[model samples]
Target: MNVSLQIRDVPGEVRDAIAALAAANGQSMQGYLLELVRREARVARNRTLFDRLAGKRVRGLVVDDIVTTIRRGRDDPDRADPDVA
Candidate 1:
């Protein structure tokens, strides 16, 4: 379902700026605003999903310590290959 949206009390300069930006991007003002609205909705949906999963943990999965992982990578003994040089 599609419904018309009306925005009131927008300053002239702000409206003109949006129009100019839409023209620069080769889109009508309505299309540009619709795209912006859709992007914002997607961000809100992702935030909701993360909030729902805030403290729940899956079983049987061990998460490694970050510092230890980095140190192990840095201290690798077989880093250099003799064939490369």
Candidate 2:
């Protein structure tokens, strides 16, 4: 499948640089952009790195939670085990 995009107001110098970089990477400008899109899509689907943060609330953390988790990890050796209760 092929998609067409229209990019406007691109400075000539920047466009030349992008074209040179893409050529160095063995891709046309369009191919480079498409590859970048595909990579980002795959990474998003993997949901391992930064994708786990989607639609989550994290503004309510206090100092107690931090200290508690640290203490628990240090105090309990078996807490991280899944097969043992």
Candidate 3:
């Protein structure tokens, strides 16, 4: 389903800035706004997924532990394979 959205009583400067951004990106104002809304929706969906996983255990693994292990591996210079280059 598609619906039209209207912004009432917008300040001239803000509206102009949005128009300039849309033009610079080679999109019409409507297209630019639609993209922005779609991106925000994806962010919201990801946040909801994270919230749902906040307290549950997945195979007895802690999220923080997983993150720390990944970071440690990333930060170790010796982990890089020079021969690959």
| TM-score per candidate, chains pooled | 0.65, 0.45, 0.65
Clashing pairs in 2: none
Model 3: residues with Cα > 4 Å off, grouped in runs? 58-85
Q: How many clashing residue pairs are found in candidate 1? A: 0
Q: lDDT per prediction?
A: 0.88, 0.84, 0.92
RMSD versus native structure for model 1:
7.0
- What's model 1's lDDT at 16? 99
lDDT by residue for model 2 over 1-85, one digit each (tens)?
7667788999999999999989999999988988888999898778765556655758878999999988988789666667667
Model 3, residue 53: C-alpha shift (Å): 1.4
lDDT of 3 by residue, 1-85 (tens): 9888888999999989999999999999999999999999999999999998976746878889999999999889889766697
TM-score of 2: 0.45
Two-way TM-score contest, 2 vs 3, winner: 3
Error of 1 at 25 (Å): 1.1
Q: What range of 10 consecutive residues in model 3 has the weakest lDDT sum?
A: 54-63
lDDT of 1: 0.88
User: In model 1, which runs have C-alpha deviations exceeding 4 angstroms?
Assistant: 58-85
